[model samples]
Target: MVESLASPWRHDFPQLLENPQLHYLDSAATALKPSAVVEASRRVLSEDYGPIHRGLYPAAERATDAYEAARSTLHRFLGGREDDCLVFTRSATESLNLLAEGWLQSVLVPGDEVWVTTLEHHANYLPWKRVCERVGATLRVVPLNTDQTIDATQFDDLHPRVKLVAITAVSNVLGVALPVSEIAARAHAVGALVVVDAAQAIGHQRIDLATWGCDAVVASAHKMSGPTGIGVLLARRSVLECTEPLLVGGGMVDLATAEQPVWAALPSKLEAGSPNLVGAVAMAAAADYLSDAGIDRVESHVAALTHSASEALAQLRGVSVLALDAPERDHGIVSFNLDGVHPHDVGQIAGELGVAVRAGHHCCQPLMQALGVDATVRASFALYNDDTDVDALVSAVENVIDVFGVR
Candidate 1:
């Protein structure tokens, strides 16, 4: 058994302690919430429930204050400027769609090109694809290297007609970090705007919009131990000022005449209706918890777990660990396949043994096709996981091989 790199802060999460036998390795899908986040959410739902930005009552005022405060917290957490507009959405998918419909559709024209990578999740890929189709623009792809990371050298293939580049900071399936800063610099040289899908990277790495030099970034709250139904889109102030709102309704309009309606300011104009106030508060608490724990320490801890688990799994016969021969650059995700066993069956068997993992294409069918596999079993680590969880996962896979007789 590998020595325990037990998380000192694991006790902060009540869900992990609630079921001692359960080994949750599916954090890439959604993280288990910490007690602070849960308590914060409960407090909001129980005491401060009210419609925001519409009333002068104490409860309404408190709700609006808390909601906007949450935005401020996230902005600082992400290293965003105070003037930047952070729009709240249901998920990263909605954030990308908003940019597609609100920003890209207005700017793109026939014969223009957009570049995306093979490592993108469907949320990042499909939006650009649809936008390009609608505007008669061409969607180009940056192929992946043999190790499954983005081939940065191929970025020169970006034609002068390329108007935008949409890419992920990390691959959801392979966990390899891409050179977003380099890509952004290259794309900017060609006068193309860069949009980053940071859903998988936000929880594992420190995000600084200024350092990346990208025009926009989108990430989800749930993946970082926050509440569901809340996500953030941080864009440059200039970009938000010019990009139109995807959804227009109450709370987003400043003035509405018979023929013309003036939209509200930066953040509110993008936020179409009553926002997920409770979710925002909980997500803020989550961000505070991560910050207090030190994101660098959390990242280092998870990376160690990933390396240990990947090395162990690679030693097992009939288990093909993806990117095992390549230099280690994964965050915390380790995807693999058991010979002759389908990924879903592998996941089901692991679940029966109290080991939770994710199976299937992981919302990246294009990536799956590029990998030449229909699906993969992914065991993703988080701040709450330890060596015991890795042992449990390896034991479960051993049981799977025994049951299937895969030599």
Candidate 2:
């Protein structure tokens, strides 16, 4: 087991410093904001702020520059092409909803199918399902392997009725990183649009849009140590031109008339109403912070912590880890169930001990149904975590076992 006893970058998070006893392992839900990210938000909201794409004053110009510059930074971060369309939204949830309402609703017809995996968070699944329901299209679920990992071969290229395949780069519950690029290739062979939900993979992995060959992608900033209430939708220019915008008003219109409205081009058309200026700056700062820390180093460090946690949990007689037997799949998360103990109870007890883990279905009720369980305890890692955090989590789980008297 490759383990790091200490994290070099842990000092960057002020919350950890403020409460040294707090072991926050729920990074899969939302990461703890680093000082750099917090400072970025503080500076944007308190100072150095201005209106974007409106007003002729100096402050407005600077605001527009900062907002667009943040977009450009994220575009470069995703290794986007010149032809890619990057639009900001409220959250990854809104981005997915936009695709479902703006794009899929136009193309889906009776007997056509939209595909999603059982591992999806409700945000990815429900929007498509609702859109498909309205359009008389079917929502087909791609099943998981017996080990609960996604199989790349299950994409099923021969299925011609499938118009889109929406999959996640990482399973939030299992922590198994799927071969989305491989899946994208197979889906592309059949001329299917591929949309990846990168909300979980945003901070954990480096994403290359060109290499993934997906038509579009969505991610949330809060999940990656950025401020909440802002996310991004990135798509091909084709998707940008063809799909209609979900929200309409102020900034997105080129010309409005009595009969019809002429929409603005690319990103401005997609982003309607007032933008979250502070969120954009903070997210970009988070991207820079992660880049400086080295994504590969972050990946390795988290893998080691996950491996240690998974192995330790497995050794306990009553604990059942909901992960693949393959240790290589360990990617900053370890979710499990303790025998005969409710996950809520486990979570509550863990929190009391200052080991904060997520509990319940994790917004993946379908996945829970597949696993024959109602809920689970999810402990996820980040760059700020170390071996000590893993030990605290294990110790808390042991305390749960003692309290519940589970064999």
**TM-scores of the candidates in the order shown:** 0.97, 0.97
lDDT of each: 0.89, 0.89
Model 2: pairs clashing at backbone N, Cα or C within 3 Å: none
- What digit string (tens of lDDT, one per residue) describes model 2 on residues 1-407? 22556899899999999999999999999999999999988887777788898879988888888898899988877768889988999999999999999999998889999889998999999999999999899999988787778878888543778899999988888888888888988888877899999998888688778888888889999999998899999899898788899988989998977469999988899999887889999999999999999888888888888888998888887999886484346888899999999999999999999999999999999999999999999999999999989889989999999998988
Give stretches of model 2 more than 4 Å off. 1-3, 326-328
List runs of model 1 lying over 4 Å from the truth.
Answer: none
Candidate 1 residue-pair clash tally: 0
What residue pairs are clashing in model 1?
A: none
lDDT of 1 at 394: 96
Q: lDDT score, residue 297, model 2?
A: 88
Model 2 vs. true fold: TM? 0.97
**Lowest-scoring 10 consecutive residues by lDDT in candidate 1?**
323-332
